[model samples]
Structures are given as C-alpha cells and as structure tokens.
Target chain A: MEIQRLSIKSLTITILIVIAGFSVLLSFVSGEYFFKAARESQLYSLNRVIQVATKEIMQQLHDQAYDIATALSIEGEIPKEFVKAVKGETKGELVKALDDPLITGFVGAYIIDLVKVRAYDLKLNFIAESHQGIQGLSPQMPKILYQQGYGRKGVARSKAISGLWQHADKSYYSVLVPIGGIFISGYLEVVVNPVNNLVRLSEKMNSPISIRSGIDPKRFYYEPKKSTEKLLPIEYELKTDLGASAFLLTSYEDIAKLSEGVKETVFNTISVFIGLVLIVLLIAIWLFQLLLFKPVNLMLNEIRNITDGDISRDLQVKGLAEIAILSGEFNKMTKEIRSREEVLTRLSVIDALTKIANRRKFDEVLKNEYLLGCRSGKPLSILMIDIDYFKQFNDTYGHLAGDDCIKKVATALKRSVYRPTDLVARYGGEEFAIILPDTTKSGERVIAEKIMSEIARLNIPHSSSSVDDKITVSIGGYAVVPSIHDDPVFIVAEADKSLYQAKGAGRNQFVLRNEFNSVI
Target chain B: MKKNYLISFIVFLLLVVSGIARAEKPFAPEKLQGTIRVDAEAAAELIVNTPSLLVVDARKEVEYSKGHIQGSVSLLDTEMTLEKLSKHAPDKSTPILFYCNGERCLRSSRAAAKALEWDYKLIYWFRGGWNEWVDKGMPISR
Candidate 1:
C-alpha cells in the first residue's frame, strides 16, 4: 500500500505488537531471572530458619537428656540394684527409658554410663536385633551407634563429635557429647531424624518439600518426583546446641519442588502480564481505527468526490481537532470551486462589451431551438442586422464614438426581439444576428421595423458616406417552420439572401423571405 | 615539516585540553536536564508543585518493583522524544529530571542531559534513589 494509505490502526497495532512482544520476551527472560533470584533468596532464608529451629530444639533435647541421666545416676547412687543395672548387669531400666513418650518425637537420645564397660541400650532397642542377649545390645553392637564398648569407645573417640552416622543400615546425623563425672565416664548421644524436620518445614513453605535421613553410603534423600533417580542438590548445614545433637537441616525435595512452583508462578504471572498488554494493545488499535483511520478515510473520500466534480455532499465528522480543521477546509474548497465554475461559464457565453448573448451563445441557442422546431413543426425566424455606418462616423467622431453608436443600435435590436426563445448576438464588427423561435416572415418583418425605428431614434452621427449617416441599420429577415427534411444551413443562406437584397436596395431598408416569394 | 608538525601538535594538544575541560565541566546544562538524565525524586517533588516537570522513570522494569516515587513517569530510554516534547512541553522553562535503578544506574543521567538541550532550566538530580528509600522503611504508597 502507498505510504499515505497506511492508517493509524495498522501503525498502532504494529507498534503495540512490537511493544507487547518485547514485554513478553522481557517477562519471560527476566521472569526466569527473577525466579532464580527468588529461589536463591528463599533458600538462603529457609536455611537460616532451619538452622535456628534445629539449634533451639537441640538445646531443649540436651537439657532433657541430661535430666534423665542425672535422675538415673542419682538413683544408681542410692539403689544397689540400679548401680548393678548400669554396669550392663541390668537392661530393663534403660529399655524403660528408651520407650519413654517424652523421647518419642525427638531424635533418640540416651546415655552410656561408661563407669561400666557393658553398654546400656536405650532408644535403639527396636532396630537393634542381636543373636546375643538384649543385655549385649546396649549401644555397642552394630558399630553404627558406638564402635567399641561404651567405656572404651567413649574414651577413644573425640570428647565431642558432630558428623553423619548410620543406623538400621541407613545414614543419619549424630551429635555425641562426653559427660565427665566424679565416678562414672559417660557420654550422651543425640540422633535427630532429619526426615521429620523436612516434613515440618515443607508445611510452612508455599511450595512442596520433603526430607530424608538415615540413608546408606550414598544416602538417597527425599525426592520430589519418585520416579526420577537423579538427586538434585540439597543445601544442608550441620547444626548444634549445647544440650542436644548436631542435626542436618535440609529438604532436598522441598527445594526442588519450591523451585518448580516458583518457575510456574513466574510463568503464570508473565502470561497474565502479557495477556493484559495484549488487551491494551487491542483497545488502542480499536480506538485508533475509530478516532483516526475512519475519519481520515472519510476526508479522503470527500476530497476524491470533489476532485471528480461532485461538490454537493457534505463531510460530516466530529470530535477531533485536526479532522475538524480538514473538514472545514474541504467545505471551503468545494464552495470556492463551485463559485469559480459559475463565473467561468458566464464568461464563456456572454458578450463583455454589450452585456448580451455573444455569437457563441447565439449559435448554441439556435441549434437547440432549431431541433425543437423540427420536432414540433413550429416556425423558426432569423434576422441579420447591419449598421448603415458612413465609415465617416468614425472619420468624423472617433472609434470610441463608433463603439458607442454600435452599442446603442445593438441594444435596440435586443429590445425588438421580445420572446423567451429569442437571442440577439453581436455577429461581428457593426453587425448583429437575432434568433426568433416560432415566428414567420411577417412576424420577422415587424421585429425588423421596430429595431430599425429604435436605432433611427438614437440619431447617432452618420455624415460622410454613401448611406444617410445618422446610424440607421439595414435589416434582413427569414422565417420557416422547420421539418425533418430541412437542412440547418439553408436557413442561414435564406437570411443572407434577404440581407443582400436590403443592402442592394440602398443601405437602410428591410427585406423578408416568405416560403413562396421574397418581399421587401 | 617541523612547522607543520608543530601546528598539528598544537591542534592535538588543544583538542585534548578542550576534551578534558568538557569532561570536567559540571555536567553541562545540556547534558544535565534532558530526559536521558533526570533526577527522579526532585523531579517528583517538583511535579507535585508544578506538574510540568518532565519526570522520566528510567528504572529497569524489575528495579521499578521496589516501587517508583510518586509523580515519576516512565519514559523508555530509547524512545525518541524530541517531537513529543515540542508538542507536550509548551513551556521551555519547565524543569525535567530522570531516575533509574537507584545510584548504580546510568540511564537516568543520560536521559536528564538529553532534555537540557531544549533549554529547560532547573535541572535537579536524585542520586540516592529506589534502594535507599525502600531500605529506610519509608512507605511506598503504590
């Protein structure tokens, strides 16, 4: 399309599409960037929360474990039987301690009173199965809890150990602290199940999460997609409190699930944002078409019509400044054009000097009247008038006076032809022609006599030539009722003959040609 | 040859000195007040008092997140604005400023100076911007 033909709607839509497309692409790219940023930030925050929570919970557990041990140690100091049980000589009390409801929710906590070489089994009795007796499984058997007997192992390992360990053939996080006493060498071990912590943390987050602990060498932790074997990275940290075990605070599955959910949220937000932009673009395009394109087309259409010469219609539009201005301009232009055309038409048909029909107009009227007369079988009449100028009029007066005289005589001739269909023309210099529709030869003669008398009364100077020079004019008249058989040129010839006769008769006279004979 | 070299050297030294002087001049009014480098906070305050101040928000859409100062309008850094300004900015004497992602950004500085060439006076700069306002716990109304 031509550049001018391009409408605002197309331009606006193009612009909006470009803007919206760029916005969408930006949202997609930057949304991903934002999602990654949010994920990183959330992970950092969640890690901190888990660390704090684990430390607080561990502190509470440590104090409780110490209290339980203190209670047992005091009881052992008084009761001989409790003292004997402490030496791996009795298993019932420790078993009773492991089964306590207070320790159920906690990562299993128990004390190995090292004063006795025999270990005390508590909190691990269910998972600890030995072919030997329950007394033998006091905490030393599996190498998962304590490698050697309680006394030897407790003394040999670091005084406080914080690291990952295993139980039930699965890896777990463990925190062990040695408690040196007046009589007994003892240590307290706290094992926290990371799985439970993961479950709790997941509940708080807007996205999904999972936790796992006590895995084997390659510990397979919580998985978001159970079918996927690939393990995404888990950001875990070992946490410790004064009284409780160092625990692993991490939710591998939760992190992955949260990332996925964040990605989805970013996608959804971007989609909605892009959708809103698209809607705005559509509205803009619609408004452009209504307010800009359609009105401009109307202006163009009106302009096209005016150029094609149909100036009758009005351009009707409103509500825009530029369009209103253009419409006003268009109306003004059409009005000017129509008025100018009227002036040109008048200039073409009227005589500038005499203010009467000129030769061109007379010829047009004669042809039209001749056609009408032929169709209606009505008579058509013609008169040819010549001024009886002595040439001496110009010789005596001046060309200006000659012109004045001619104008007066032409006016008289015009007054003589009175019918609506009659036309008088300045045929040439000092000569005039009259068309009389539906007039016969006698009628033509009467008109000629009237014109002759009117010119004679003007009494203009006619002193120096062969004719009486007081500005009289010779008149020739012819009339015929035209027929289908008549030739238009024949009428003019007959008028010419009568004019020759009047001129031949001595300058100032009238001659008429009837259908049968010529009369003068 | 020596005279020509001396002349060339003088021209070169003059060019260098002039360049350095241009660079050192306190961001010329032309560069200071255009849409490319507007001072957002001052522009916002000015807009509230006099709405004619051209307040261009140059923040990347994301940094705009911390929330824009009120009365700061967004003008894409790349969009041509000379024609728009001629039509819209009836008063040449009105103030104009721009702001982007706090102090770490360069978009606002360039935009501010671009508006200055059109003969706008009263150019102001808001260097410590979005981050500072948000960090201070000031209320972002929108």
Candidate 2:
C-alpha cells in the first residue's frame, strides 16, 4: 500500500518532463519566428542605408561635372608670348588648367576643349583621352554635339562615356557644355569600391551584415533540403540617373548562419538545464527511496519473513515518521506471533497419546516429500509397520495399557531411524509408518529391519499365539523414484501386501518389495 | 591590500549594524548620525525621525532590569488587553517600536501585534533591545 503512494513520484516526474518538453518546443517556435523577423529587418535597413549613401555619392558627382563645365567656359589671361606658344588653342590651356585645386583630388572630373577631353587625377595630372575613356561614361550626362547618345540605342548605352580613369580602375561620368563658343563634351569616371562601404555599414548595423556592389544571380547560396523554390532570389537595383547601373545581390545564408548560432546556443543551454534537472530529480528520487521507501520495504520484508515462520529476526529502521511507525508495528506483530508460536508449535503435528507425528502431519510431510522427490527425481522409500495381535493386547491389557504399549513401541521405532530426513508418523491405531526420502530399496529394508528389532527389544509380552511369543511388528517397505503418474496410495498398498506376507511367514520381521516397471 | 581592507571594513560594518535596527519600524534615535552598515538600520533611520511615538517592551521581569527607555511599558506579563489601550495610546497612526532581549527573542516582536490588533497602526520591532542601546549612548533613562 505504501508502494502505491510511490505513484506520486512517477506522476511528478511526468509532469516536470511534460513541462520541460513544452517549454523547449515553445522556445524553438518563438526562436524561429524571431530569426526570420530579425533577418528581414536587417536586410531592409541595410538596403535603406546603401540607397541613402549612394544618393549622396551621385549628388557629389553631378556637382563636380557642373564645376568642370564652368571651368571650361572661362577664359584665362594668356600672355601674348603664351598665346603665340599655345597658337590660341583651347586644348593646351585646358590641359594646363587641369592642375587647379577644383579638379585635383576629385573622384571624377574631366575637361573638354572642342574635340579633345582631358581628365584630372588626384595628383593633378592631365591625361589625353584613351579609347576606353571615350566610350564609357555616366548615362545621365547631357550630350552636346557629340554622337555618343544621339544614335538612340539603349539610352544608358548611348549616354555612357568613361573618361576619368584613376588608380588603374575606371568609373566614368559625362558632361557637355559650351567653352568659348565651342561645344566641349567630357566624360568623368570613378571605380566603385563596395568593400569600405560594406565594412562601415556592418559596423553601423552592429550585427552580421554584407553588401555587394555588382549583382550576379549565381552568387546566391542555399542548401537544397531546407531551401524551396518558393524562396526566390533577392535582387535590388542601384541606378544613378548618370547612366550608371549597379546590381545589389545579398545572400540569405548570412542570416541563416546567424540564426544557427542562436539556435545552437539556445539548444545547448536547454540541454544543460534539462540535464541538471534530471540529475537533481534522480538524486531526489534516490533519496526518497533510501530514506523513505527502502526502509519501509525493509520493515515490510522483515514482517513478511517473520509471518512466514522465521520469527527470530526483528526489524530495525530509523528516520522518517511513516517508516518508524511501520517498524514499530512490525516488531510488535512479530513479537506477538513468536510468543503465540511457542505455545501453538508444541501442539502442532504431535499426537496427544503417542507423542509422535500424527496422521495429519504424516499426510502433509508425505505429500511434501513426494512432491520434492518428483521434482528432484530422487528415490523415496516408505515402510508401513503394524503391530501384530494389537487388538488382543488391548483386550487383555485394557485400552489405557494398550495405548501405553503402542506409544512405547512408537518411541522405539522413531529412535531406531535417526536421519534428519526420516519422518515417522502414527498413521492410524497400531499402524505406524516411516517416510525415508533419497533412500534405495536396500537402504529402506535395512532401516525397516532396525526399527523392527528395536521394537522387539522393548520386550512387551503378548500371549496371543499368532506370530511370536512376545509383542512383535510386521513391516512392509516399498522403494521407488516418485513421478507424476505414481500414486502414493499405490506404493502404500504394495508395502501393505509385503506386510501381510511378513505376518503370514512370521512377525517381528521386515518384508521388502522388489523393483517394478514404472507405468509412466 | 587596499581591496582586502575595504572588504573587511564592509563586513565589519554589516555585522555591527545588523545587531541594531533589527526592528520593522523606523528606528529614530533621539539623535542620529553616521553611515549604516546594514540596510535595515538605514531603513529604520529613515522612518523613526518624527515625534509622537509608542514603544512596546515585551521582555521578561528579570530582563527588564539593566535599562529600558523612558515612556516605554513592559507588555510581557500583562494579559492580552488590546481593547484597553485605546485611551492611553489613542492615535492609531502614531509610530510604535517593539524590542526584547536578543536574537533569539521572538516575544517582543509577537507582542507588537497586540497594538496592531487594537488598531494602533504603524507598528515596528527594535530587534537589538537594551544591549545595543547601551553600546551607543545616545539617550537613556531607567
């Protein structure tokens, strides 16, 4: 019954595990949603930042182009000797003016004198127009008497003229204006550097972030099993009206990686917490068993063993209210039983008249020995012994003296065979039997003869002239390996036959039955 | 060495202040100064500054010896008569502080509730009692 109360422990463990499982599941679901929302917000914010910065860059380019146009329009004071050397050529004067501070250190700037274009470097060097500079430029730049965009292909292709070549990387812008009544067209360029922009943007974002200047559709990375076709490619365009087009490509993998870190951390922390909870719970359960359940069971077991007939041992338990109570109850119960058994055992399996094992005890012990012999495949021998002329002896000596004589012979019969396994019983009036387990036929005969002789040695006189001059016994013994099919009654009948034969031949002797074939 | 010294000083201060202001109500001494080593002392100092107060003593007859503050009464031997105190200590809102012998003393603290049962509000316990009061000689009367 106390064991039934232990269901509470299992119930508590189940409830805790269920709570933990649900919490982990909820955390995973919420974490997934959080990762999705954070990644999208990060991307949107990065795009906005790039758009704003690029707009500023475009505005600066447009302003520089206007200044170059203004510079080309002005006429510098050329000395007569300088004019003679320049031959009044606009190209020479424009090239000489390229060293001006306005043109120097600028990202993209170009000056055109009639047909020729000169671009200024950060070092203030003026270089003649190369083939590439003449072709590529910002598409937003205005055309002036130049057939560049006038051909009307794609507007971007026609307006593009790359002229301002710097740092071995060319990024160009185009401008057209009138210089001294002559239409001059110039192309300015810059090389787009997204690395610095991306680094700075990442710092501002204060999270994992990236930016790419040129878009390539192939740059997307995805895992096949987790990615579906529904997850479309991310594409955004960067357009400066000056005919520059830069595609923006970003990977969702970066977001995925960040989410993985979070997932791993969360799972690791949960696993550790779960492990700790399990360990603590295990210790609690063990303590409950040790201090509570185990001691209680021990008291119960001691009680069980005492009730089962071992009354010597007592229960010893300490600690815990319930267990202590149980221990006390058990000790009291076993003590009562031991004292009661002291009285009851004397009356158990003992004949009041003969002081030998009674018929009931013989039946119980015979069945037990027979069952044991059947199980163990051992031979058991039984002897059915009857005193000859017992009725006449009772008639002469009176019932009391006859009862006394039977008891005297029964005592002698019991004392003759003294093995612990041997059992002697007063089967009925004047009929006593001995059950010898693990004995062969010859061994049974030898024991039966000894018991017969010991009874004769008691030397009680019998005047009845049927078998012998003195009181005597006729013993019949049968030995067999007991089995399921063999009846104990059949063995007793066979021994009884031998007993009749002994009485017919002469009393005070034992008759042995030879081995017979088993019916089983 | 400086760090260890600072730590030791802090521990010492905490122990000393812990001995005093062991009361629930603010402990406003007749005169007050110095930093508190314990949070409870600081809390008591904050509330006990005003006048018009009731102080209950729950110490035994032998313990009431040595010293006790003026205007304080021993309620330990008195039968539970919360209803009779309405006339002598009329204001239910007046601050009250209760104190007994030492750390093991729960008697005075329990007695403080008698005033509360009578609906005398603002009850407190001075956990330190006479031993701490004599250590710091602010003000005293037999």
Candidate 3:
C-alpha cells in the first residue's frame, strides 16, 4: 500500500476507539453480572440464615427433650414402674404411675413450652398421658413410626426421633424418646409449642419470624398483611422424622439492611469496573502515543518538509522498534532524493557531446562576471567563435564527419583559453562562446588569435571549404569593464557583430572589439 | 512438574498406608461359632454385678453410635482382629461380653465366635443385643 494510505493518525484513533468500546462493554457486562450476583448471593445467605436458625431451633427441642428423658429415667420411681409394666404387668398400675401429681409436676418444672407428655406402649399404642387429661393428638401413634416398626426408633436409633405435627395454626415440636433407658418399655412423646421458643428465635436473630404451614416460598417478601415495615423474607423447612416438610419458618429481614448491602455491593462493582476501564484507556492511549502516534506524526511532518523543497534534514524519531525502522527508511529515501537532485543539477549545466559547459552555464557565468566586474571595476570579455562553411563540409563529407569536425574545432577553441577564470561553452550547434573575466582588450585579441591557430594546427580535412583544404573557424572577441548600469548581453551582442565581420572578411580569421577601442 | 510430584507422592503414601493396614490385621471368622448366648436382662445383671466385665459392642461405628449400651466400647465384627480383642481383654480369662443389634443382626454372634477362636475364656454373648436392651427399657445412655 502507499505510505499515505494507512495513516498512523487514523489507525491510532481506530484502535483507541476499539479499545474504548471493548472496555466499556467489559465494564457494562461485568457490572450487570456482579449486580445480579451480589443480589442473589445476599438472598442466598439469608436463606442460609433461615436454614441454620430452623436447625438450631429443632436441635434445641431435641436437646431439651433428651434432657427431660434422661431426668425421668434417673427418677427411680418412674423407670421402676415402667420396667414392671414392660415385663407384662397390668396396665392399671402404669396408668396410676403416669397420673400421679408428683410425676406430672416434675416434668412441668423442666420446660416452659411443654404441651404434654404422653406414653406409647411397645406396640406404639397410646397409653396414659399426664394427669392434666389433655384432649389432643390421636390416641394412635403417628402411623409413619408405627407402620415402619413397633417403635423401632426407641431401640434402633437415639436422635430423639421427632416430627413436627401442625394442628391448625399451632405447630408443635414433638420428640419421641425411649423413656425406660436400655430396656425401652415404651416411647414417650414430648410435645412442645415451638412457637414460644420462636419468639426467642426471632429475638436471637434480631429479626421477626413467622411460621407458615408448608415451606414453599423460599425467597419472597414477608407477608405485607403482617406488618408495615418493609422486609425481605427468608424461608426454611422444618422437616420431621417422617421426611415431610412440616412448616415454613419465614424470617422477616429488614429490607433496609439488605438494600443497603446490595447497594454497597453494586456501587463497589460499578466503581471497580469504571476504574479498570479508565486505567486501561489511559494505558492504551499512552502506549499509542509513545509507540505509534507521536513518531508517525513526526515522520509525517518531516515528509511534509521534504515536499516543501526542504529535503536537507533527516527524519529521526525515538520510539518503538518498527517506528524507528520506518524513520530510518524514510531518512534513507530522502538521502536518495537529494543525491539524485544533485546529479540532475550537474547534468543540466553540462554539454552532452563536448563534455564542457553548455550555453545556459555560459550566460550564467557571463552575468556573474559582469556583476563582479561592476563591483571591482575590473574588465570582462567574451569570445563568439563559428566554423566557416561547415554546412558545405557536411554536404561533401557526411553528417558524422561534420560532427567529428565540430568536436575537434570546439576542443581546440577550449584548449586555447588557458585562464582558470575563463569559461568555454557550446553556445549552440557548431558555435562556441568563451567567457573571460579580468581580461583587457589586448588579452581578448590574443585569445581569439590563439583559438584560430589551434583549429588550423588540427589539420582536419575539409575539401568543401572555400578558405583552405582543412577545417577552420572565424573568431570574434569583445572586451569591456562593466559598470553598474551595464548589461552582460551588450558584451554578447558586440562579440556577435565582430564575428559577422570576421566571417565577412573570409573564413579562418579573427576580429576583436571593445567599447573604448576603434575596432568597434 | 511440581504438581506431578505431589500427586505421585500422595498415591505412593496411600499405597504404602493401605499395604501396612492390610498386613497388620488378623483374619476374622465370618460365621458364628460356639458361645454361651445370654438374654438382655441376664447380660445387664452380669454387667451390673461384675465390674470386671468388659462390654464390647460388635456393630459398625455408625450403628453403634445410634445408641449402644452405656460403657460399651465399639468394634465391628468384620473389623475384629486378635490384637484388637486382646487390647480390650488382655486377660484371656477375663469376662468379655459382646452385643450388637438384636437377633436379626449377626455381628454379635460372629464377634463372640471370633473371640472363642482366639481362646478367650468367660465370653458372654448377649445375643438379644441392643434391640432387647432398649426394648426392655433398661437403663441406657448416649
């Protein structure tokens, strides 16, 4: 491609724009992604809080039930009677033992949320409960435990086999424990209202909580029907040994905190994105300027200078390797152009055939001599020489011979002028002019006569010549000391008039003229 | 290159550890052998009166942890070795009681039988096991 086709300035701008676009896109996409992630993670953590709280509440119930069971087992009277009952003793005594005020009172003192303490037989059949004669819960065992086995939980496992049984709006946390320790006469079901402890659960969490029937809504706003304060709801399931979702423990988290956290997260994400983008943009621009744009612009200016005819200076740029190389190449190109121009200048001042100065150089030197003569009050002279009957010689001999004869005559005329300050030029075809600086009138005549003798000595045959059977030339000379108002062309005109007179006298002759002399 | 070495070293350590573990264990019998199998109440009476009796729970640790009799140290029948048995009851004549999940489970029987082969004396096999213990509502702890 041409050098100007891919301008570095335009390329830099394009690359900068592309980088900016990519950075903006990255920032925007990441901002969106992080915003969603922040919100989702916060909501997820709230759900986690709900899960841990429910587990803790369930764990507390199990621990309390286990402690109560251990206490009852330690009470000798209760276990002793239970053992007898398990050994197939009559149920009347066991009923009496369970209904006793002392036994019931002892259980009541252990827990505050205690709903009831009921006993199940080996077949998990309901027997006698506390003397309060509470009318609740079916007399039959929970079918899940009964159908699985005859209270195998009382023997097989020891985690206080529990289930959450919801009756109306009141949900009870019930634990099934083997009451008589190792012998396990029957299972004791301790039913406690988990809602009362939930008050503490809410207080412990520093949030409000509500128990729904089933855990379906995991992420939702708290019931607007309950309170006016804006709140986010986090929910968890309280599962039972029956492996059923018993209740939804929904904790109302103040939206103010969640929103503040989300806002901070989102703000930080966007700020970081913007910061990264800005840093990237700055770095990219700096690199472009340092490595590409600055150097290219410098090169362009240098090239402009070259185009404006100032090819002397070289392009030097300190930058990236490629840009340095490009500048070096540009400098090399300018050097080539300067050298070629020098060659063209030299060729323009030279005559092609004679290997001497041409007419243009002659006039230029004559004018300069005239000016110098005017300044120094010195004399300047010009000689106009011509070959006599050179056309007849060309008709007789051939054009090649004519050219050879002209070359010889011009060489003789040039050799006769030995002054370093003199200039011999091929004024036109077969005509020559010599410019002499600091030459007086006699000196001019001497140089014109010497040129005639040099041509004669060459002895070049010219049978068609009217003067002699050899090549010869007519010489005309003029000398003048130029003044400030004098034109160099006056010297040229005087020399031409004298040359016409000499050619009129006959060929192979010389004539000299000067403004101060009578030969003019 | 560093990662490769770490992985190889881990694999080598695993191989060496497993090799030593395999080499260290003694053979245990799979089937039940001769032992005096007592009921749960009788076993409880023996344990209550005899402070010298060592109660061995012959169930997997997970099953045992669900709840075993109080003061019973757990060792699965499948994992039993002569060294392990001796560690529990150093005196061959010491009264050693073994129990597992009740009659449906064979861990106690196999353990008791393994003990008999090891020439241990006074091995009481509580065949009714933890099932009968809890079923009878006998005194128990976690």
Overall lDDT per candidate, in order of appearance: 0.60, 0.57, 0.74
Candidate 1 lDDT over A207-307, as tens digits, reads: 34344332232343554544323433444544222222223344443456677888889989998998898898888777877888888887788778767
lDDT of 2 by residue, A1-520 (tens): 4767765547656666676677667666766776677668766765676556544544454444544443333233212212332344454544344333233333343322222244422122222232222345333333222333344321121122322222213223345332221111222222223332333332343333334433342442212334433332333355333434443433222345665776777677667766766677677667877787667667667778777878888888885887788788878877888888876775688888888888888878888888898999999888899988899998988898898889898899888887998988898999998899999887886787788778778988888646777788888888878888877777677777878877887777777774483211
lDDT of 3 by residue, B5-56 (tens): 9999999999999999876553333434556677776776676567789899
Candidate 1: stretches off by over 4 Å: A1-20, A30-34, A58-248, A255-331, A442-446, A456-459, A462-469, B1-142
Q: What DockQ does each candidate score versus the true complex, computed on alpha carbons?
A: 0.01, 0.00, 0.11
Report residue B71 deviation for candidate 2 (angstroms).
Answer: 54
Q: Model 3, A122: alpha-carbon shift in Å? A: 3.3
TM-scores of the candidates in the order shown? 0.50, 0.32, 0.69
Best by DockQ: 3
Question: Candidate 2 at residue A445, lDDT?
Answer: 69
Per-residue lDDT tens digits of candidate 3, residues A325-438? 888888898899999999898789988888788999998899898999999988888889898888998999989998888788778877898978899999998889999899
Alpha carbon lDDT at A261, candidate 1: 88
Error at A91, model 2, angstroms:
99
